[model samples]
Target: MNTTNSIQQALFHRFDREQWAELRQSVPLTLSETELVDLQGMNEQLSLAEVTDIYLPLSRLLNLIIDAKQQRSFVLNQFLDHKVDHSPYIISISGSVAVGKSTTARILQTLLQRWPQHPKVDLVTTDGFLYPLADLKRKGLMKRKGFPESYDKKMLSQFIADVKAGHDEVLAPLYSHVTYDRRHDEHQPIRQPDILILEGLNVLQTDADTLVESRKPFVSDFVDFSIYVDAEESLLKEWYMQRFLQFRQGAFANPKSYFNHYSKLTDAEANAIAANIWDTINGPNLKLNILPTRERADLILTKGANHLMDKVLLKK
Candidate 1:
């Protein structure tokens, strides 16, 4: 292992991109350009090279961890002298919005499914657990829609618990970005998946109010592994603005889109709006809630200004 900054944070074992890439030798790229295009988010150029260097190694490491966990479960079951219920392994991917965590989740799901284990994998985003627009408005939290309080944390926690308890089927709400609301009528059925990847902004966060009140499990408690995507504040701001412009040119122009009004703005006007949103909402959320939990993740992928992962930090 590289000795750089090893003493800075004893809990994390850091590895540069080159070092991490070497760990994934001979792992063939399973995804083609067409599939990559569909899995990636808009405005983010995710090439096969990047997948091979970063995500492929990540998937390989996860396979090892899953194997180890299953072996341990087998021993425990034997010790108990009976069959013990072993739920699907859950992975939590968290980061600020527009940081490519969604793309990472999708890529991982595809890769893990292709592994020899042939585990049934399902991906769920915390967006589905957010309070409905009407509910947010009624609670006077419309402006803080992505904040922790804007989500039904109790319900979200319960849903994860049920899935982790080996439930046969669990129902989660569906959310629509175009409508910018939770689709209450639609429910996504998550059956007995061998692995469940839970991605969201607040998946790793614990409600501050819940700290002193109860011993309830937070959504993260059910996660067998967790990853956090990280980048400099300035770079994240730039990415957010770029994505906003792309949306203005595409989705925002649609009449049915919630942000349709933004399509009429000039580039300068749109930039100003994006800046304001970052400063007021997303920025604060990252500093206060999200980034604070970065160390809580089992692995942290640090990105450079170009959105390429430059370093990885694994919890020792």
Candidate 2:
């Protein structure tokens, strides 16, 4: 079974506006108005129509994978002559900042909850694993907070390992994006669920040492499925600037806001700040770290300028 260039192309399903509508009709949503409202409340950008059409079938597919993963784990345990411990099915969602990762997580939680088989899905974000504010300042990494090196790789990897190990209770650190600090004292506990959705900018990353040691499975190894949300860098810059403006109007209004100065900035100034941030931080991170990991994902959701999924690329 040697490699061959004849390996087939990874097919991407391009759904035009009409095809998307027909797909929605094919898989009508069972959601009630109240649940739809709650979902909209979480991600204002996502319409109920998007959820019912794009995510419902996606959730159905995931439930199948979750079930299969449990079976696979059981067989592997029997092969190893070890006890079978059915862990939560883990799916990771990684993308650039402001690329709608939070929305994707929320949509998944909502959709997965509706399925009887996976009613207890939990979403965990890596924001919690960042170094505390004092620690960041001490390390002189305060300005580079979202960079890969700023996080506790060992702890984050361990958390995933524990979840995959079927630990009954896992505590993850929490972070305050508004205050721009890690809330280490505040440990968020997560009991086992049918599925655990880990969403963040860099969940796909792994330690170099882990790679060198063949026995040490990468964090991605624990992922039964993964998605990389994609959008053009030019569009991402515009969305980032738009979100920064929105944050300035809302969160930054608080005097304690880490970006309180943004609240006082003129629209033009805030736009410039957002642009600078993208050029300096997010852009480089995407090109250097995040984009390369796209190959590791089982699926890629390619979005258009408006951020809706234009196509879904599934690795065969």
Candidate 3:
């Protein structure tokens, strides 16, 4: 079998229930509580064990690719008489909301950093590229927040292109979940790093409309590898609803919570509302716009009913 199939077979072969047990021995996790807290948006706290098992080997394998890519590019550059920085490899992680793409990105970032050659792995979510709620409202897209039309596609494309071009620094907007919007006045500047994992719902979009409107190269064109988190629609709906209720009881109870208004509802009420929203908005976006891009990914991590990855599909 090829390397791709070998990786898939290794992952799938270890997918028995409680497979994390076997994974733990191979990929020891040492994430501190603070690190987990920092990555909470992706449920990093809940999935650490699985992260060790699934992402560690994957990270090691990617480092090998990064090295090979650099060597190949160096040989080509020698032939053409040109020079370019061998900057970090980038991985794009995409999936429907609450499918745990964020966590996967964070875990992979942390794991890759543990490798000697890629000690400076960094993660940036696509949320920062989303238009602020205020902008969305003015554009009359408040009802369609989180949809493809709600992003500043031009800016997002430019950001990716700048990073790929090895700009001294690339700035990205910061988002405030409390305000449920972008913090326009503040930005985070990323210098070049050894590895960058860009994670988001629509990170894979490259439709003609986007190309025309953004007027820049598609982000995926820069990805060295990409992953799409896969799970049954029913399981995703359940996870989304459960996470909604959890957030309501925790974050939403805070006055600063953007979703504080929902804090007053009972769990049943929150579940119903979350389900309805998912069915109308998130589910449709995943089905119509996002999942079609699954074929563009280099690897897929498919979760079972227990919310564990049971099978991994690698593209040939």
Q: lDDT of all the models against the reference?
A: 0.89, 0.77, 0.77
Off by over 4 Å in 2: 1-28, 32-44, 71-84, 207-216
Indicate which candidate wins on lDDT: 1
TM-score of structure candidate 1: 0.94
Model 1: CA > 4 A from native:
1-8, 84-86, 207-212
In Å, residue 231's CA in model 1 sits off its true spot by: 0.6
Give lDDT tens digits, candidate 1, residues 1-316: 4543444278897899899999898888899999999999976887888899999999999999998888888888899986767489999999997799999999999999998773699999999999998899899988787888899989999999999998989998999989999996899999978899999997887645254765778998889999999888898999999999999999899999999999999999999999999999999988878887887889999999677899999899
Clashing pairs in 3: 88-194
Global Cα RMSD, each model? 2.6, 4.2, 4.7
Ranking by lDDT: 1, 2, 3
**Alpha carbon deviation, residue 45, candidate 1 (Å):** 0.7
Q: Tens digits of per-residue lDDT for model 3 on 1-316?
A: 9865465565533344344335334455667656766765633245565555566556656767887887887889899998767466888999988898877787778777877766887789889899888788899987677778888877988887778778889998988887888986898887898778899988787755343565456777778888899888998988888888888888788998888999999878898899999988889888877877766677778887656777666565
lDDT of 2 by residue, 1-316 (tens): 3221122143344455445445434555776667656654212455566766577767767777777877787889999999867488888999998888878887788777777766888899999988788888999986677888788877888998998878889999988868988775788888888788999888776554233555555678788789888888988888888888889899899998788878999998998888998898889988878886776678777778666777666667
What CA RMSD would candidate 2 show?
4.2
